[model samples]
Target chain A: MSLASAPPVRARAVLPGFRLTFGTTLLYLTVIVLIPIIALVIEGAGIGPARLWDIVSAPRTRAALRITITAAAVATVINAVYGLLMAWVLVRYRFPGRGLLDALMDIPFALPTAVAGLSLTALYSANGWFGAVLAPMGIQVVYTLGGIILAMSFTSIPFVVRAVQPVLEKLDPALEEAASSLGASGWTTFRRVIFPAIMPAWLGGVTTSFARSLGEFGAVVFIAGNLPFKTEIASLLAYIRLEEYDYEGAAAVALVLMVLALVLLFLSNLVQIRAARYGAVTA
Target chain B: MTRALLIGLAVVTTAIFVVVPLVYIFVQALGAGWSAYAANIMHPLTLHAIWMTTLVAVIVVPVTVAFGIGAAWLLSKFQFRGRGLLITLIELPFSISPIIAGICYLLLYGRQGWLGGFLARHDLDVLFALPGIVMVTMFVTTPFVVREVLPLMQAQGSDQEQAAVTLGASGWQLFRRVTLPNIRWALLYGAVLATARAVGEYGGVAIVSGSIRGKTNTLPLHVELLFNDLNAAGAFAAATVLTMIALVVLVAKTVLEHRR
Candidate 1:
């Protein structure tokens, strides 16, 4: 029982097979993920920073990055607001088909991105269902950044809903009651008492969806029409660069996507910690 | 009332964005009549696509499951240096664009790649081939099982297992009789999600698959190919298969979440 007694065999992890499993996990991760990423990074770096800058700073690459970031941001902002609305509706309201709506939130999580892309294109094309309605107003979605935003939003839909739903559902009803009793309208009660409570969670969800939409590919490609200097996106551009045997081009393009991913993940983690702190205070 | 108005907007948005796309796939799938749908399903290349997709899943799910369980057990049970970094690294794939993952494999294994000469000298192919697709798919879907199972294991604590060990339960016995049953649902959930992503993978597979039609095209890629070839009915028909899978996964997820 003494501290000098070989740490009492173990502090935790009473199970056996730790070493074997740990080694295998590391090996699998290295082969499957680490090596490939390192190769890509090395390839990108091998091009020299000067050449790398030249490739990435080209007008074509700049436009792709701008379009990708812009569309992803637009989609994320929409989903963030819409997601709060959707989560609130699902959590606060009781109506027929409620359970169905709740379960249906994960449709984007389950649906193939390519399928989503195809169907979205069909639904928004000039002769298609909603497209027919918007076309008369001289509004075009497909082959434009609007289509890109739509595809990104569609695939990233589940993140915001899933993230904020549980938090909203778990909010104390008494908070709303107190706010209302204090001469608050429904909107005011929400803004004052409810909004701050859910703000961190909402931000977390929005950042996550933003991150997802940023890297989105399959769905985006189909609807984007892949028009260079216009509808082209970074991920799609990376693919095209690889296809054209421009390995350096592809690596540079992918490196940007990778950097964006790391940044978004960092941001998501920050929001999560803040959200957790807020949650503790509210609770 | 604004209440009704707000809810109505949510409903309409969901209907258009979520419900319609789902409904559209099925309707277009069946648009070509029952016979056309059946023929598309029965088409040899379509069948091959299904087989290839299934093969990838079949290989990936179990390997990932094993890796997931092993990693989760090691990770959740014991504290070690660099644990946080290891976790972040495992989760790195989730946020990385899958297309980038594919480009990575292509860079390492493609004919012009660094290892290309060695692979070619060995007469081994890993790029624009089955092995390449498998590797990239594995990379992209890597975190699903671990992400699902790790938290479950962590929250479970080691109390029960510790008690079992003191009572003279062997490692194998403890795992089989205690640990396995506890995490079974989460494990299954992880497998299902991983399988879903694996089957539906398009970006990474699209890169390494070379879109070799009958040779390497998975179902998602095949759908893209069909659409590209102006075969709308065929594309929809193929997409219907994926939609059905999505529905099944949704049901499973809801059931699992309810249990939780």
Candidate 2:
């Protein structure tokens, strides 16, 4: 009866360009993104599962994956703490050059990875600025695992900071105030109230940062020394294979990195969805 | 005391991790004399790389903007099944490595690829050329414009568009008068982001580029070549140019964020 009384629903009544716009979107996406990605998968599949496993299980490939994952983990851990601190400080504190500092966080996103690589390499190489001081302490950063971690952190740090900043900014002061009035100390309030509030976003940020770190190539290659099995990363290994015209090997290595990244991306999206649901309930 | 300590720690760490590298670029660029820096920038290969990078941006940005607008309009205005999937697919490149993106294109267009024989018969070169560079750059930056414009469009809603339709405005007129005006800032913001990424894309371009100096090499690739040739000063000088572009992009982004 309500349906009889209501106006007829016509999908195209309000918007006239749906077909045109949607067609263009699908066409462009298929041409630019989907097809190329499918090509990689098809290439990998054509290599057959047995050969794919063999390529992946090869010692050099295994070592590269190990180093990539290890460095990515180290970078993610560093970013988790540093990013949270930067986000908290930026949101909670006001000081000279705070705005400038906040803006500078985007440098990694904007600057060319090659430039970052060259500059970081310059700074950490033996005679370079930081290297000169660090050389005396016998801490070599360039051409080592440390350099790989540094590059990963530099490029991916903004993910965590940007992700956590808004959540921190929007946090209800009343929660912290209530905890403090109930005799909770600052650290206690942060640990119990603030930290939980930011936990989902922090997790999402850390996941994405790890994903980005794992795929990092341009910034890492220059600093990483690309020593096979020692410093070479999975993405770089893929590059090496491609250069050697070993298409099957390159596709295999790339498939591993792609799967890791896709898994991380899916995890980040899940956290985001959960966070949104949680926010909706709380609000 | 705690506040000072936290702020100091943040400042110092940022200076070391972020600011110092930026400063080091310029320092090393000018480490030799001004003339050497000038010479590096003026080098024929460097100039060619600059030209190649600029040409790629010119082709890529407009196409991205158009695609972005179309995609954003579709996603923001329509409530359809698989909408979430469409959005995730749009953003898929962000998660994928640039090197993998390069490999994907190479697998599709390389001499041994899907269209290899067809292209070879026609003597057409897609890989190791400008087309490959542009396509890969486009892939790397595809999400920027949509990511920037979609939320704004969703929030703005279709009220004005509906009104225009009620008044019998044509599609072009409706978009130009209503949607375009509303989304211009966001669109420009996205375009700026896309430009930055397009200009700076290294890994994807590097793979498909073959690093052919002065021919297929981009500015980023050029810097690597100079660096590998042990021309650190020249590499840094070329890097300074990119640093300036990055600085400009940041300033534009800050201004646009304020406007939005």
lDDT tens digits, residue span A1-283, model 1: 0011111123354567778777998999999989999999999889999999998999999999999999999999989988988998898888888899888788998999999999999889987888999999999999999999999999999888878887887888888888899899988988888888877778878877988898999999889999998999999988888878899999999998899888977887777776665552343
For candidate 1, write residues B221-253 as lDDT tens digits: 999999999898899999999999989988988
Total backbone collisions, model 2:
0
For all candidates, state DockQ relative to the true structure.
Answer: 0.58, 0.58
What's the residue-level lDDT of B243 in candidate 1? 90
Candidate 2 local lDDT, A50-153, one digit each (tens) = 99999999999999999999999999999999999999999999988998999999999999999999999999999999999999999999999999999999
Task: Please give, for residues B1-260, the per-residue lDDT of candidate 2 as tens digits.
Answer: 88999999999999999999999999999988899999989999999999999999999999999999998888777766666667777899999999999999999999889988899999988888888999999999989998888877877878888888899999999999999999999999999999999999999999998989879999999999999999999999999999999999999999999987
Give residue B103's lDDT in candidate 2 (0 to 100). 94
Q: Please give, as one word, the docking class of candidate 1.
A: medium
Clash pairs, model 1 backbone = none
